[model samples]
Target: MALGTIFQHDTTDPLAVITAPSPNESPEEKAAREEREAEARGISDLIDEELRAERAVRKKEEGMVKILLLGQGESGKSTTLKNFRMRFARDKWIEERASWRAVILLNLVRSANTILHALSQEMDDEQFGLDDAFTFDDYYRRYRLRLSPLLQGVESNLKRLLGAQPEEIEPQKQTHPITLSPRTSPEFFVRSRTWRNFLQTTRGPEVSGCSLEQDLPDIIDSTEAIANCKDDIKTLWRNDIVQAMLAKRRIRLEDSASFFLDAIDRLSVRDYEPTDEDVLRARLRTLDIQEHELRVDDDADAPKWKIYDVGGSRTQRHAWLPYFDKVNAVIFLAPISCFDERLIEDSRVNRLEDSLILWRAICSSKLLSRTILILFLNKIDILEEKIRDGIMVNRFLPSYGHRPNETSEVVKYLRQKFKDTVRHCSPEPRTCHIYTTSVTDTKTTAVTLISVRDGVLRGYLKQADLF
Candidate 1:
């Protein structure tokens, strides 16, 4: 204040006052003052830059639509999101394919383990009356011979990524052990930072062998070993002992490791590349929500698409509310085939009933009243197969009374049920864009995706009064 008053009130030459430094000020003090001024300028520039960036993001979001994939666990939400990437951002998908190799191998190993466990169950349980034909020693010997190498390879891969097995990697106790079958239990995902680091840093080791015998030695040897023992697998599947056990337990072999059993010969091949269907059928549960951004083009005006793949389990639903307000649309996946299945979180609730309750709550929520809703009645393929196998709908869904158990009739009935639920519960009456989707089928899903995109765009435009 004293310096300011002298400058303002004193009768001094203007040029002398402006050009002269204070007489008592040392060179060091002047230098420090300059340094402080420069830092202040830098901070001011940074703030301006951040403000510009914020504006750009806001502008981009104004033109972009954010889609949230929602469903109960195993309802194919992630698979649907993967299909979007496969269609729109193919280059990125190809780049990530190498990482998926480990996941595919893990899937194969888990399948083999499951089959061994089922066989073990048969030998241990007297209720199945299967002890006379199948002994643990014989089955165990066959498993060790045919599957041990692959299991070892899986272990090696896991060790490289995690330095620990899947069970040892942050193992958690089951929340609903009674309701969930071990088969339906949540499986591991290759989403850890350690896995990413391994994939990025490591390289495959070289091998020396004959061309015929060791083609693709870098491709895990267990893969070749499994391929070589296809005959043994088929024999195990067709064994009279297994057949008797199946009949006694009425075990639906078609549902679990049956896919691997059927395709052992093809999957075991050294050159095998996973198709879109193979990736979809791979059963790693979503542990957390994943976000992917796609830019349609490099043009300034090209719209950005932000797609969120949310975890759909009961426990994971709590994380969903934070995302609801800003979402432009929701692609709700409901598996029509899960009518006979029970939820892994709570066994008392049938899977289909759980889906209905979830759908109703979503439809009725005021926060999402303006959001476009596209209902994917997914897994129709599985539903058709189940119906074909004489799985009576009324046995599990008593309300589906006296309905024809044929695929077409059952699908139609299920569709109407969803339609009715939406009509009754939706806060703002709106038409639900429903599709009977087999998300595993690429062609069908692509077509449905186009339709959904158009529907969501139209809804958004209408909301903005720009349509």
Candidate 2:
């Protein structure tokens, strides 16, 4: 370069003068500059280390399989989750088994109290006429009186202990106008995690410093009360008049998950232990999203798993969208047994129709379009029971159109309807596996779960090109 060009470049750029070392710099100035450079490097390395640690934790979580169970209320999402935990996380189940005793007792007391209220409603109804055959006479009055204290004492305290409350039954404007007496409402559902922690609280011999006398009275007294009333329970449940009253109101207590009325004899025993089947069948409505973790394979080589179970009620659905973005699979359960039943939240809407609408929304969700879709046409057992009792599918579902009312045919029809929804409504073509499941039946569900877990892992791995 020419001398004139070099001089011009040095004058034009002002930063060169500051960044360049002085021609006559002292040794002290050089040492200070080098020291500053070393400190900056140290700071930079610390930041890089923090970032690397955060990424490692995030990657580990992402590497594990994540499943979300989606469905409407009482569609067996909790039961399905229990199956996964029971099969893969047996140790946790075994540890928690004894704790479920209190829950089962609460369920029994709730059922008994419901029957008394129903009986009282008829007797108090002036419209039924004093001369009605199903009179709430002195004999029934004695049973009601006997059960009241036991029910009140255990029900309230127990519910408070477990952090749950009784659900209100409201009369809807659209459905048949039937007044549900407030006294007859017995469904107590968990509204908070306090009850979940109650399990741990009940596990040990004592709670805090309290003695067994001042102990969780509900836990101790429930069995004795229910046992003393066991004969009375059997009598009330088997009474023809009581049955007639419930039947006239179109209330089928037998069909609900919380209905353990039939097992009073076995359950009333002093040392009653809830069997595996009992735990799966116990119905306590989950109010919010519940997270469960399990190692799917044996500990030596198993991958971590995260399963999320969300409450399926209309109000709870708003919280579901955020979870749809990064899930491996979403198990959608539609209870076929509810074909003729109305939703508890809205009596005017048919439960089956609500499920179909929910399914359509899920299929159309852009966030879930890429997620694996697995449909469980759940509660086939109840569907078959209804059919055997002469319930015609076409009567409830007009479009069903005289197709044979057999369970296989009904399942096939519903399966196709869901399949078409995914095919047409989804943003893109995706694979959806449909399984006929009675999720309450743990044995049958075990097979379906294994097939689903393997299929989900393979599909997830294939998309990641890790297979």
Candidate 3:
């Protein structure tokens, strides 16, 4: 019987002989053959549709306005990028929260290690222009015996979790072989799935046979200890000896270390999920350019925005050139709070001074002259805090003559300075908009992003003859 007979009555008439093919062919065979052909044609049509859709998507992307984020390292480029994701692509950002756990842990552990280093330096009298506040021998002895072990434990844990550098791996080859260094390896962040897996693991990495501490603590460990022992950490941090030593060494402890220090209790919990603010505060040096495609609207006709964030270190500046020609606009972030700070790579160079020079280079560059330039005078929150804490702007920047050491005064002075720098160096002498921003503040940053999007789109639409 023919399969078609299952769906419809099988009837035969003498008139049907006009459509009959061969007398030897069975009705069932012809029915099954026609069904298979139908399926093949349906699949072919679906495939063709998919190919056309992909081509259309690619074509749309080619016209998407590309915005390049440019600034010095630690200048909040990554944080601004995070703001865009949170505002426009919340679903994807939520999905990646787990991966950021490792980064947050890494930042905390690094801060602890830095504080320990400073303490060690004080013990050795390595930092000049510092008087020993601990006249009693027991203060030194107790801190050394107690805090030293904790610091050692933290460092050992960090090394274990991050994996050893290529050179250090051979030394521990029997235990854990050379994979990649999360702290130093540029490729690990961008390419290594092994590292990414380590980040996503819930329980944390298994420590090898090295029992430096009874149990290697995770981020939770450091946070718990710091929180429970808040008084101890605070006393140690604000001790005249530590403060004087930090000041002499010009270490910006507040910027680098305060995030973990401030929220020690909250971060220690095993069940703790990182909030948007936590993610913003979490510091990881971006080692390469990251590009994210954002959908401004759900409609298929909506436009796409391509945002690029590149590493801003001195060596990383070379990578910026490759992206310059393609960008429709550039958002340059200069952390104005860094006026009193020095670059980590070069202590002699003032951070603000370095930023100004980088800005000048960018503005004057022939490749970027026609590119829309928007400056974010970023980290205003930190600047306001520093001003309140009695950090005089003129002390570091002598050019600011007779200005009051207040937030409003400092902002005004810096704004004028930035505007002057742009005016003096911009190759095209066009008006550049500057925004005082704290990238960590989502609501404010989101609003700023909206304006920025509109401005960039206006310029881009005009260029594309769409306006």
Candidate 4:
């Protein structure tokens, strides 16, 4: 009876139609949306607080920890920095903390190149004409122009002497008359009384025409005669031109040396080709390398970090020694294929050797008395063959006793050798750890972490309270 009444009341009414909620529009969906919004807000607050706390901690750790990277030129220092930046971008710990400061990357090679380029520019700007041939008059003119400043007083005196004695002037033809007699005296035909007086005054008693008791007026004529001979005497002083040229040369040499030395002092020196343009280009390119400080807060109550990146270059190794004094940990980067035959054939082993030298140098530095070393075996993709084939062997041996074949055995040998080497450098052997990493990948590139002596690294970091 109830069903019949309902059908009769709204058989054709639109309100009588019943619909159910779609699967996506249920209460569960709304609850999930609310939960996500709450979680997002919570994360945002957490991140903001963490960043604030990290900044506060870093403020106290400024200039505390300095880490350096050292290797040969073109040994992937720039690539490593880029990879590090990418890691920071992807890592939740770095992203949430927002504690990184600016990254400062300096290239010594580029700096030296810049100074050389500037010198070249200065050389090009000099007024010295391109043509090699020069007339005597042109040479004399250049000599005078260059020496004008140095002989400014002498020039002024000469000008004043010529200006004060108006009576000494004569017709140009008379003053420089063409003489047939090679040894004729310039005063022979001085008929004017003034000229005669000038000759006597200049020639004095020692001259043939002058007497010991000659009066002042008679001596004036001799002075005129001597003045007439002044041009011949002036020709003898042209040797000063050589002095002026030497002065210019000295100036150029001194300026170039000073410029180069200043550049070296600022950026340090690195090896490279000697092409003029290559030097310039390298210097101009250095402006793009950036430097950054990495700070990490391990515990809320612990001290912060002021991390430094030493960059990669053999010369930069010396720079690392100073940083070790203040650092708690050292991240030593080693190429995965550094020990591989192909890498050696490609001459990349030279770079690895340079890196090892840096490590050895640091171990010997007094500043690193207690610093921990963490070896990062980068570019592990190429190392897979050696690891799988069990063909890895120790290439560096001191006693020359045993040859290693298996990868693990080779690694152990290396560890022992490195440990012994460090012991020689320090009273106590500093702890070291190893890790495998691959920074790049492509269709042709396959990288994997074959093996890592993580215990050694963990132990060091733990001892230093840096993990």
Candidate 5:
């Protein structure tokens, strides 16, 4: 009876009658039609399964908090992320502490080489008295020859650690693998996602192959190379002539993010491990967006956080849009200390001005309008240092208008400026938690982070009706 009904429906539909299979269709054609239908059904099932899985994961992560770290290059975004990892993901930070030894070694080498070059340039540029000229020339020739091997090895050592072969990658203007060497770049750029892997690889083996420290303690090969020239490094770094050259030429190595010159004695030993402060202070520039997940607490029900540290150079700003989706908050770091400094990318633009431009743009983005905005007027320590050194805020920013050039007053004034930018530029009403931070000072930053964590938890509680 069912078969007869099916035949009746097919015969009654005029369109079906015309579209029906040919009465003289071959067996091969019938098999092909059935095969095509089966394949189409299989594809549809696969897509449905993926959709279901994605939804399930999304539901599981309902309590997850997503925070994006945005700032200009050298504004301390990566440093801020390090603090989060140190506090929330303590075990991982400890595990990776040894890996940072190589980077620190590289930083020290870079500082030495920078002085070497600066001394060379000073000798070439200046026609000092006979005694002064003789002293500089001797210093230049002796240290340059001694540090020459390190100069040669640093580039190769850095490349091997980054997992890039000479033939595979080429350095170009406005691109990745920006040399950590000061001669080429003031900031070191690395692939963010695999940041620790390369550093870990180079930790103990490549610099001095067959060293037992690789297996025992993870002391990097750069340690041995650096150890060989430790005295020369110390002498040159502390030399009156070198300091004079740096000061007069305005090559302030002390002002750079990778300033490890102060800790040469502690850092130059084999089996050396980076202290938490050392790790926090280390310089490793991020090239692309890096995602790190941390369990904010030690409970089964603890909220997981997905922190995104995006690259902050002008060219990298376009990559930030996709991450603005579903973001819970943003921590925008504006380095107020850089008021008198200019950007590495564009010399015409002051660093503090670039930071302000970035802050305003972030404030005005409609996508981020509803998200929590935390403004870190970071590097307060540097600001205070500059202020005490008689650097006037009014000199760079006439709008500062002769405010008392004290740290507290400067911070207060800049905080108002940042707050005003958000007030005027945000697409809608929002709350911005502004903090004067010196992120490298982990002790103080810990207190700041506690407030940040508490606020995020409160929001989650309210959402779950448990507050």
Candidate 6:
């Protein structure tokens, strides 16, 4: 203050005095800086509010659905999954617009011993001990670590086959000559002599030692040699006979060992060869995996379902019950054509019992309450005239405590029975429908829908708004 006062000089104009203040002047300059800081803080607060609004809009774009399939073993669960995957993979909407992540194809069937052995060369300790009590999560984790590699192997083999060059088609090795045990029967010696004499007469002396006795020693050297030669001759003979009968192209085996090896190789090679069944299973698995992915992230894009391949195992079917609680619809498979005229008789009564058990199992499940059940009468392609006559149908009804023999009548009876079962099990009853499906040679003949009942269970589901 003393220094300031000493430096101060009187000025006539107030403006001049104000301008004359040193650059180091303090309190007034500090007040001006505080005003600028408050304005910057206001701008930052506005930015954060706008960011949250944008995120809310993004979250609204995503939706998800979960579905479960349940059935008995070998009821075409895998086939259904594969078909669904194929359909989805080829979908234009998903392909052109969506950010398609990789498909996670998990096969619960792999947990089954039959399928696991088929897919892998050897089983690990965990695989050997899989049980019905095992949960889907356990299988999913183990499959990721262990079974995924086997799938990669399958993919690699398929790629190699697809990329094979012309040079890869080498001529098959010829089968080693097989040595027959010395003819213990006199008839064999007589036949051999006659054949040898005939060959010598027509082809000259060079063919003299070409019989089994002479050629076997040169071809087979030890017990191992004979064992190896066995399959070679069998394969060569089978191929030759088949080609002759079919009068078509032939597959020649190089030798016996090769034939055995080729058989083993075929097991692996066939996995890469896509069939109708394979395509179906892939589609189904893809659908399940996609659904699981969507559920994990609630903010994912709405997923369109491609297929529903339900598990057919008794244990797996139990696991699938909860999934039905979330399903909007259902597809039921019935092999009506599997019924035979023979099944009508008392001697074949077990067939009817078995059929009833299967139907009861399906209808008794929790699915009856949650989804629209569509029954597919499969194998109609092989339906016989006797079955269509409805005699067998009538015979079966009495055993199940229902009226006998009218096809329409039987269907109505079963439908009512299922309805009652569902009502007893679920708090609410829903619409159930039936359709007769068949496979035919022509595409035009495939997938004929016989009938649909209007609002049968539709009203019930609508009233409840289960979804």
Displacement of residue 62 (Cα, Å) in model 3 is 1.7
Candidate 4: tens digits of C-alpha lDDT, residues 1-467:
57436444454555553322233466887687678879999999999999999998666655344444434433334344434333322242222111110000012211222222232333444545444124333454443444333222222222222232323222113554332111111111112243223323333344435542333232233233323333332342334543343334322121112233333322211221122211211211121123444323334443333335453533333444455555666656666354532221223444445555655776776766776666655555545545675543445323424664555454555556556666677656666655554444411111111122234334445656678
Minimum summed lDDT over a 10-residue window in model 4 is located at: 97-106
Mind giving the per-residue lDDT tens digits that candidate 2 earns over 1-467? 76335444474467865565555668999788889879999999999999999999789877777899998988889889989999999977866666677667767776677677667666766446555634567578888877776555766656655665333222122354335632235346675476567655555554323232333455666677778888888888888877778767665453442357888888877777788887877767656789888888765554678999998888899999888878889999999888888877777888999999999998998888788999999999989889999989899899999899899999989999999999999999999999999987888899999999888988788867889
> lDDT tens string, model 3, 275-383?
8888877765535567888986576765688989888888789889999886788999999988877776676899999999999898888888778889999999999
Instruction: Estimate the TM-score of every prediction.
Output: 0.79, 0.81, 0.73, 0.35, 0.84, 0.35
The regions of model 4 sitting more than 4 angstroms off are: 1-59, 62-65, 71-290, 295-304, 340-352, 385-406, 439-467
Ranking by lDDT: 2, 5, 1, 3, 4, 6
Question: What TM-score does structure 2 among the candidates reach?
Answer: 0.81
Model 4, 65: alpha-carbon shift in Å?
4.2
Cα lDDT of model 5 overall? 0.77
Locate the minimum summed-lDDT window of 10 residues in model 6: 97-106
The TM-score-based order of candidates, best leading, equals: 5, 2, 1, 3, 6, 4
Worst 10-residue stretch by lDDT in candidate 2? 165-174
Model 1, global lDDT:
0.70
How many pairs of residues collide in model 5?
A: 1
| Candidate 5 lDDT by residue in tens digits, 231-258 | 8887877788777767666665634424
In candidate 5, which residue ranges exceed 4 Å CA deviation? Answer: 1-42, 127-131, 165-186, 196-220, 252-259, 460-467
Runs in model 1 deviating more than 4 A are: 1-52, 130-141, 144-146, 150-186, 192-219, 238-257, 295-302
Candidate 6: list runs displaced more than 4 Å: 1-62, 82-88, 91-303, 306-308, 338-368, 383-426, 439-467
**Distance from true position, residue 93, model 2, in Å?**
0.6
Two-way lDDT contest, 2 vs 3, winner: 2
